[model samples]
Target: MMASCVFSRWKIPYLASMYFRGVMRIPSKESFLCSRVMIPDIECSSSKTMWGFKQYHDGRPRGPLWRGKKLIGKEALFVVLGMKRFKDEEEKLQKFIKSHVLRLLKMDMIAVLTELERQEEVSLAVMMFKVMQKQDWYKPDVYLYKDLIISLARSKKMDEVMQLWESMRKENLFPDSQTYTEVIRGFLKYGSPADAMNIYEDMKNSPDPPEELPFRILLKGLLPFPLLRNKVKQDFEELFPDQNIYDPPEEIFGLR
Candidate 1:
């Protein structure tokens, strides 16, 4: 049981397609002040807000601080409870629990990131990235960087995009094919085919096995640039021998 504190009036601007940004620092202690309070058993299908982790939005002045802290607390408690149930080979299970806790921490961070995106809080999301980068558990991954880049690109923050991309490299985490696909998509949407092609060029050198999805997405994105489309089409065919790659309709190429 937890003690009840002031009913936090914190609210995150509810947004459709929200990408939250948060670096959840789960407490190391087993006990929490929020443990005494009963979290309303509101049912939700969102994996991010499971266990009645509803975002409060009473038009409060405070943005997300109150909600994020409480949610992290609940998640920490859940982790502790989950570990207790894994009773057997106590030593081994303890190791498993530690790893799982890190995963939960990651889930919380991603939840916040996505929520922030949904809210269109790009600045906050960028700040959250900085905070996450400093965390001991933070590991740069392609997917994580993908979403961040997309957000930055939409906001036309090219400098931030380049910095993040460079930081990702310095972390010894090269962009994967999917990351290339997304950055290319962002560039296309930003009306910069040249930048998009630059990513495609780098993607050609990625060591990760060639995937059909990135190629397919890039092909769609390249529809406006016939010359570029042809270039990618040739590479797609060469990389995917078992699959059939189709060109856009003749009408798309302005042919009768």
Candidate 2:
């Protein structure tokens, strides 16, 4: 008689019909227990599915898990150390890189080149950078050029800095304020005020708004050249009118 009655818990008429069909034939103790328990299990499992194991309504699974930034791999370490080790022996270094560096992945090559730049191994870093440029995957990345230029400028390798700067310009990459400051300071320190002024002109032409730091650096460096210093001072006053220009006494420039 109970089997003859439709199950109210199963809202679907088709599901209720199926349940009644099974119940009508079977009066076993196990069947009676399963019918009661399995209904809750089906309802709860569908509602409480884990996000990680979730599927589309059509039942397709998600794609691959996301990967984070990878660590510097063993190949990168080996290349960095090898470049350092072979620093004095140019021929041997060439051979070493040719033999081992080819196997390195893109990230590994970038890592090794960056490490070399950090160590101020300008020649090695530049060589590896050129190698990276030759790679099929090499795109014109501003940050890569920025780091190398900064390192070269700090080391007073103006020739290399100029070469990299030209290459960067060819690719339409403009240096940031920090880079312009470092490079201008480098030229001034290298006793090339003319070159420093040339960079200042480029900075003036840059599409990005000029920064105060580079102006300050140029003013300080151009102190010996009052004419040049006056040009920068006037511009500084216009761009940052509220800011005070620290005009050190003329004696500092040995003018007094």
Clashes of each: 20, 0
- Candidate 1 — what's its lDDT? 0.63
lDDT (Cα, tens digit) per residue for candidate 1, span 1-256: 1222222222234331143423343432222322444334432222234343633323334645455554555664444345444544567555754575445566665665655565566655665567566678877677777788777877777768878888877877777665676677777777888887777777776667767877787788778777888888989888787788776587966644
All candidates' lDDT scores? 0.63, 0.82
The TM-score of predicted model 1 comes to 0.51
TM-score of each: 0.51, 0.71
lDDT of 2 by residue, 1-256 (tens): 5654645444577777866864464344444554567543222332223542422132233322111114567678778888889989989988998899877889889888877876778889999999999999999998999999999999999999999999999999998999999999999999999999999999999999999999999988888899999999999999999999988899877976
> Once superposed on the true structure, which residue ranges of model 1 sit more than 4 Å away at CA?
1-70, 73-115, 132-144, 153-159, 249-251
